[model samples]
Target: MRSDQPNYDVDPTILQPPGTPVWVADEAWRELARAAARLDRAVVVVDCYPGVDEQAVKASLERVFDVVVSVPDEAARPTEEIDALVAANLGDDRVFGYITQFNVADLYDEARLAELRRRVHERTGPIVLMGWGARLAAPDADVLVLADMPRWEHQLRMRAGMPNWRCKNGDEDILRKYKRSFFVEWRMADRHKQPLLDALDYLLDTTISADEARLITGDTFRSALDAAITRPFRFVPYFDPGVWGGHWMQEVLGLPGDVPNYAWGFDCVPEENSLALDIDGVRVEMPSQNLVLRKPIELMGPGTFARFGADFPIRFDFLDTFGGGNLSLQVHPLTGYIQEKFGMKYTQDESYYLLDVGDDGGVYLGRKPGADFDEMFDELEKAQRGEGSFPDERFINRFNARKHDHVLIPAGTVHCSTRNTMVLEISATSYIFTFKMWDWDRVGLDGKPRPVHLDHARANVQWDRDTDWVTSNLINRIDVLEQGDGYRIERTGLHELEYIETVRHWFSVPTLRDTQSTVHVLNLVEGRAAVVESPTGAFEPYEVHYAETFIVPAHVGEYTIRPADGAGECATLTAHVRGTEFPRSVSGEDLRFSGRSAS
Candidate 1:
């Protein structure tokens, strides 16, 4: 409803016209204005996370409406009973307005929902059904609004004792408790709401003040999505402290010095990372998966989208061990193993691109020459039971690591990044399937031994990948493909893996290229920064800094890259799905070593 005093601090361009019914999915802190001039009857139904301020919302609604009714005075009644009670109150002369709690658990009852909507449709005045599931329940709503906050911000609020519907005990582990109880529900709600975005009238960034809930219209939302896909975007990086965490991120990434140590930085992981959007000098964050969900074919090429659907098939992250300890010796399940056991479509075929390394930096990769698999298994079992110690040096081979060295790690390979090194991990989207085999007989940061997965490791380990074979086949195999004035292109990756391909471009002058309907994930490995611009001046130029990762959307077709104004020559690693072409340097002999026939 209209308000002469400016009911909301929203961008005027994105606000709905007067008399539009809006369904707002919002944070507890923000509420619809109580005293709008146009609303003769207004209702606010709130079934929110445990810690929201329900009383404030009720108070706000009462200030404007002629009458306000809170249905089902008993909060624990069944949905059918609650609906009957609400229906019974509709004829009350004073019940011109209704504020009812719409619970997530009630979404399963389609028949009950249809009946409830039919009853509401018979009413005569304006109605505002505002809550978590209100939009889903009322599909014919005039406007849909999503009120969101970044996960980290929500965690901070939860830690500060924000009213939560799930957590009542006020435990010290409230964040963990809240996530355990409601994360799945939140994810489901997010997925269900994404398809309705085209009908969204306004997206309120509730992280801001109520007066400034950044309003984004449906058209603006579409524009932002297009810009997000075509431009160099950054996901909000999340950091974690682990027992084996190191100081590199704290020093290099200049993270807050308060954390004990930084172990991993999720840079572009859509499953866990949130995209930060700067809109009109205000910041708004949403799950990164929303981009892929909104424009699959535009973000990922048509071919890739056809193959993977809405999945963003690649992941990039940082593993910081500089001035710390080694990672546990681990193996990832093979493609078939993961599909059968984990119900996943793909396996984790990863690589380690060393960003920085100390003098003793090295990677524990493959098995030692002449390693006895049966003996190793016996030793592993004994170590697990505290009956014997692991002979680390005698069973695994260690390869010295240098800055910018690329180490390929196909599924089933045993590997770990050693201490005093920072690794830029590039891999398939399937993560969290690691099988730790050894941990140097050391305990975790909690002073307890970490659980090991020896059986799983043994089941997937490739016994044929010994020191000699790994050194000859998995090590850096770079071959110059083409050279020009002040520029060169080289093929560099685990080409025999048959999943994804990587190439490097070293150039000082401007270069133009097309994506060819294939998405490319790139990192400027060896320059201060570079400017990526539309070849036809269609969009703004995107400036990417050194060590920064960005994506080239499949639909962009062609783009140009040049050294940032004052920077020198630049080297960028470009990664994409390997459709059909095979590297020319990988001989049939190398393919045999990898146990794969040449294509």
Candidate 2:
């Protein structure tokens, strides 16, 4: 029999609605029908997230309204113009692109927009305007219905021969389509959507299927968003396989066996993760970021929202190479380099916390002290040119990893998590700015060579951070700040350069924690299950399992973490913005984040 003792949760949800307010199937259509009774010549706009099936919407609208106008057909920019607009961000390569500064409204024709506006006004019947950014077509529509879907759903649609918004390239490469979405379409769409989502009249969910749509009133949606920030919750985690993917997640996480392996488990990357709502027992899914967008002050705190502006500044994900191959050696750009090169606000500064590792293998990190740089770059370029494999051992330092060992990697530091290790990667939320210098001479799962940005790596690598620096500062620099009645707190190294501060707690009994005005993301790294509860019952008691990540809202103020009833010793790793002081290793009340943070 296949093994089935895995405890990974695949469908974690947040925000349980109070009543059965959702309308489904024909009831959804009837709700729209009642809204457009042709009594007063009303206009309803179904503004959509890109990749939504316009035809499905048109059919649904045609069933309810006498006049249905597709906003995309009315004002979408010409195909040639769209290609020219996104060309810079859609660089010649496949897996990379700079973030686009354009907006979805910029993809409209002003002349056509005016004409459509006139036509809608001239109509004497209940009219429906629909498409991506459809409200841009009729700004003062009587009722606003926002059709939204998760990014993962959009990726699935892309694989199903759907084109990028306003383009006719359905048969194009999937990677290119994703690149378009990542660097261009999504950025533009999100910018257009945030304000609209803030005041939407209705929130529509069509991710389950086109034929069966779920509809909820905007009031209920807002209630759900409000409820989300009062407690700790988990986002739906999505898993994917890659060239260096391994079977650990598939076996340990109880994933479907259809994929070859599970390489990445996006546990806390909300931008791509789904947040499920338990709406009267019928689970509905939406992008987790909507919570971040609609309730930043409550969820992320005022200081954090003011600093990052609705973006979830911290990220937690898994990189499993156990029973597989090495991850590509890479470097992240410095803040100035990323800002100047990619139009981004910040750079990725990360740490790899080893969850599991074998004795013979470790992580490749930093470089040998005083290595010949000219020769290393030349060799990498030659490897990119197919001359030979980049000789990693000649220049890079390999540090042996162990269970619960944390490795801090600042921007421009060369590093990679090698085979036979399960890594929980905690970092700043700039998720996709890695500059790959080498890939161990292998193609991707698509059987094509992975893109290596040797030039970018050369421009940013910190030559001074050699073996000595990494050993002294990055590897396993844990400071035991305090031991208390039933717990001890340890400050894990994330280096001074990184904005995220990580702390570990080992507890056999309940441990008290205060939010300290910053959001805390924690993982049950060494326990079967742990319980998170409010001191005064401010929130429901939340249960978390091993390798599971949950968020404590910045305003939670005070909470407690302990092993689920009768469970044994447990450990957790918590990450928050660096705002508290780090105290020297000591006894008594000097615990990192004990009463304060473990600084």
Candidate 3:
């Protein structure tokens, strides 16, 4: 089965939430009821996405309040019309509360939203503005309830036509339209929603079944929200299949083998991933962006947050090609190019750290020295037009792979992970800007030729990054930084183009480390398992296994890592922003290694 196809048979019970507190449906309803009873005229606004059961909430409110009025009887209306209707209904003497839907999808005009907010505010009675853009319009609402769903689930629901708000187009057209609108819509929505998170009176996770929906409110919600932003966290990994996907993940990761192939696994992409929160034995998933919006400073630290507002600077994911074909020969736009072209703050600067590989595994990186670029592109055009095959080896340099080999791929550098390799990609979080130059002359899983971006690739490719330069600078460069009683730390890679630095620790005993106010991304690259513990009990200890990635929040201050029981020696690779002050380091440590030189 292709990954893009809907799998309705997937068991909901398999979902396990992150250990946290979330208010169950009954508890949330009861709490809202009690609040409603205490107020003579309370304006409770419930802002949510499509498919949320607003009627159920209205029913819940009606059980406590004498009169509840749902405004703008029409499901969809223009902002001006909605404003007029809301204004006309506001002064009604019999109505105790007004529940109005303010879907952002219907309105893109900021001025119109402002006008609607002004009209809604004029009402003396309590107003319950429900929908996505309500929070942005009514920032000063007495009570704000943010209803959210996991983006993946939302997409599924949309595909299933579960929401009353329907797109006029067919499913295929709907999917195409969504794909085109996703980046812009999500960016705008996030910008408007993030600043209002701290003001939220309640957060409702609507990803679960209607009967099992969960909410987090009051102090418990605050605490849970804090934990989400300021702790070692993980996102529910989402797997997808591509034309060049492989069966390695299906075999090694124990994923369902029914799919054609598993190409990409989004381990911690907050933008596209969801947070699964464990609430009273029930699993509830919410958009991971809520964490960034709620507490950017806590998650990213002060300096990093200041530099890249709510955006998570670093990204960690897997790129598997085992038993499949090579990834497209690609180049990411330069920082300036990306910012000017795509309105992105940062460019995608990536590195491939080989985790596992077949006997003949290799990677295509850099350009061969003295390669004829004009002639190469002319041949590429021919290959793209189905006239001939691309001479890949002639234009690109190939390097044999080994476990734990780090291959640096900064922005503007042309590269791709070849067949029979599983690579852990760590880089800046500006994903989805790849310019593919070649795709092995294969069609997509849909049997269509994948779009090629030769013009874009040609504009960005760093021609000077020849084979010799790649051999000298882009390969594994390690330096022994310090060695203690039972632990040794080595500085792995700190390319001039990268803002983050990586270090590997080979330890046999418990090792203490401090964040120094900079977040650290850790992976147990070797050994069975390791436990990260907080000495002062500031946060709960978390266990990670081989190849599993975890984060250490900057505010955690100090933590300790030790091998799990019965596990002997272990190796963990820690990556963090450059220029962070370390708690301890040896001044004059041996920097030389046998296979690679530190310098």
In model 3, where do residues sit more than 4 Å from their true spots?
Answer: 1-34, 49-127, 136-139, 155-182, 209-211, 228-231, 580-599
| Model 1 regions lying over 4 Å from their true place | 1-119, 122-132, 149-187, 207-213, 386-389, 442-451, 580-599
Candidate ranking under TM-score, highest first, comes to 2, 3, 1
Order of candidate numbers by lDDT, starting with the best: 2, 3, 1
Please give, for residues 383-432, the per-residue lDDT of candidate 1 as tens digits: 88888778888899999988889888999889999988888898998756
lDDT, model 3, position 505:
86
Candidate 2 vs candidate 3: the lDDT winner is 2
What residue pairs clash in candidate 3, if any at all?
18-276, 43-127
Alpha-carbon deviation at 328 in model 3, angstroms: 1.6
Write model 3 residue lDDT over 1-599, tens digit each, in one string. 11222211112222223554555766766665565446655667677655455666566556545544443232336545544544422222221112223335444356656666676767666556665555555666677777766666655655565432323333443334334234433544566566556777777776766446577764555566577645576667777898999876676666798888989877767776777655656666677777777777777677777777877878888888888889998899898887665556788898888878886898999999879889888988999998889998788999998988989898889899999999889888876677889898898776767768888788898899998998888899878877867788888785788887888888878877767677778877776778887767776767776667777777776677888887788888887777753343324432211111111
By summed lDDT, the worst window of 10 consecutive residues in model 3 runs over: 590-599
Expressed as tens digits, the lDDT of each residue in 183-282 for candidate 2 is: 9988988888899876787888888775688888888788888888888999999888989987777777788989888899899998888888877677
Better of 1 and 3 by lDDT: 3
How far out, in Å, is residue 268 in model 1? 1.1
Candidate 2: regions farther than 4 A off: 1-4, 580-592, 595-599
For candidate 1, which ten residues in a row score worst on lDDT? 590-599
lDDT of each: 0.64, 0.85, 0.69
Q: Can you list the residue pairs that collide in candidate 1? A: 49-165, 50-163, 50-164, 50-165, 51-163, 51-164, 52-163
